[model samples]
Target: MTVTTDRVHVYADEFDEVSRILARTTERVRLELIDGKLRSKAVPDGDHGRIIQWLLRICMQSRPELFLHPDQGLKVQAYRHGRARPDASLASNDAFVGQGEWADPGPVLMAVEVTSYDSDTDARDRVEKPRAYAETGIPVYLLIDRDTCEVTVYSEPDGVRYESARTVPFGKTVVLPGPVDIALETEQLKDWVH
Candidate 1:
């Protein structure tokens, strides 16, 4: 007889055994800590998923060192007792586990998050997440704007802050972290808007 093995969810109650002093708010959205502050952002739909899927597939086949994941939480000590879960995160390994419906992962080489329904939320994805990613020394951060059909890459982060930034439309695939060039059809993400 064939048997199935049980899997432990990454984002489940795994953190409960770690610390009871965690935050009280846990929404359906993504959550993370930055500079002693907690940020909770909403989830994405099909359109956003497509962009991420495209990026990951290209990235995996092109440059396999970095891993890509969406809505996976990273337990970060760099923040003021913060936990940042990005829409799409890149780990060093090819395969990853689950934390629940989400994944509580380690410090990836890079992180990605799609914009929420709010512009302010999108702006947060642009500024704060990049800042957090850089601060944590994640090295690279990518943002795909569904409403605007734009893809932005932030590199050369210095101490929880990135001094450099580049924004590109869907027409061009982005070359990131060396030897990895994948163009995002920005228009493809338009269907995911709210």
Candidate 2:
């Protein structure tokens, strides 16, 4: 998940609450877990950040109509289910209308999570997270793996799951839903690791 961002400020209470709950989760064996089941690498060493920043830049540049997002919470709450916040989410319309204590329906169009060193986190972001996103009916999901330096785009939901998708290497340019086209350089992205 993206942390330490610009524009949208994360409320400390929400952060603490989510974090406290995540501390008890057992599914996060040997992987980075933040705010209870919200799996993400702690802080990307160096290479990871570059890929993430580049994607962010590319998205904002192409889709001027969409909300430029950071690691902000969508703040969806049900009576018993609680709330979930993705690393970064893009909602097509004003889904956050008339939210008082917290947002409902969730602010989601596309959610992107850049994978860390851990393969499990990468898998979760690539698979389970996309499942959850599909369940919410979010249009697109993006997963960036800094280790292998690959980016995957998933779309076309089928029963709380993504059945149609495309996977692109950093060498190839991938065009997002909008006019945003970004080529993630796998070699350059892994430079810091070497």
Candidate 3:
């Protein structure tokens, strides 16, 4: 069900069929419906997976009150695009129950993305996804760019983009804002060779 074009025309009702078809694929791919178009990209390399696991672990260990989910699809009504899956997501433990794989972005506090393997793929994570998350009113978007070897913390969403951002290299620490008030150490994270 993956369309080859850069933009795929589809109505909101076809999401379930699209989701089912994508689940059986072997590649590390992400699909989002944007402006009545389907955007898809193969994600970062194996190192990025490790970074996601690390971030998830740290968030879970440091903030016991907040609930953390990896690869959780978000259903945001604010955009023509209806759904998105951040690499890692953090929200209130009791935000909602039984959301059935796609939860409203209203309950989300933070979304994380690690850069993908290609430049085009990296651009999607670095630019497009953050814009979508911010517009959805998610307070935090942490982008771990492997190509640049830096982690950026984007906050203060103003309905268009994050109004504030702080970036640090792999060995430095980035402080996460509210609901996840803690400094994360990036010493264990590695950079991409390319």
Clashes of each: 18, 2, 0
lDDT of 2 by residue, 1-89 (tens): 33433424345454545455655664342222222343444545566566667656666665656664555444432222324445566
Give all candidate RMSDs, comma-separated.
9.1, 8.8, 2.6
Off by over 4 Å in 3: 1-9, 24-29, 94-96, 191-194
What is each predicted model's overall lDDT from 0 to 1? 0.61, 0.55, 0.76
Please report the TM-score between candidate 2 and the true structure. Answer: 0.63
On lDDT, the leading prediction is 3
Question: What does the lDDT read for residue 147 in candidate 2?
Answer: 60
Q: Which of 2 and 3 is ahead in TM-score?
A: 3
lDDT of 3 by residue, 114-180 (tens): 7777646555677777788888889999888877888899999998889999999989978998756
Runs in model 1 lying further than 4 Å from the true structure:
1-29, 77-79, 94-107, 179-187, 190-194
Worst 10 residues of 1 by lDDT: 1-10
- Model 1 TM: 0.70
Query: How many steric overlaps does candidate 1 have?
Result: 18
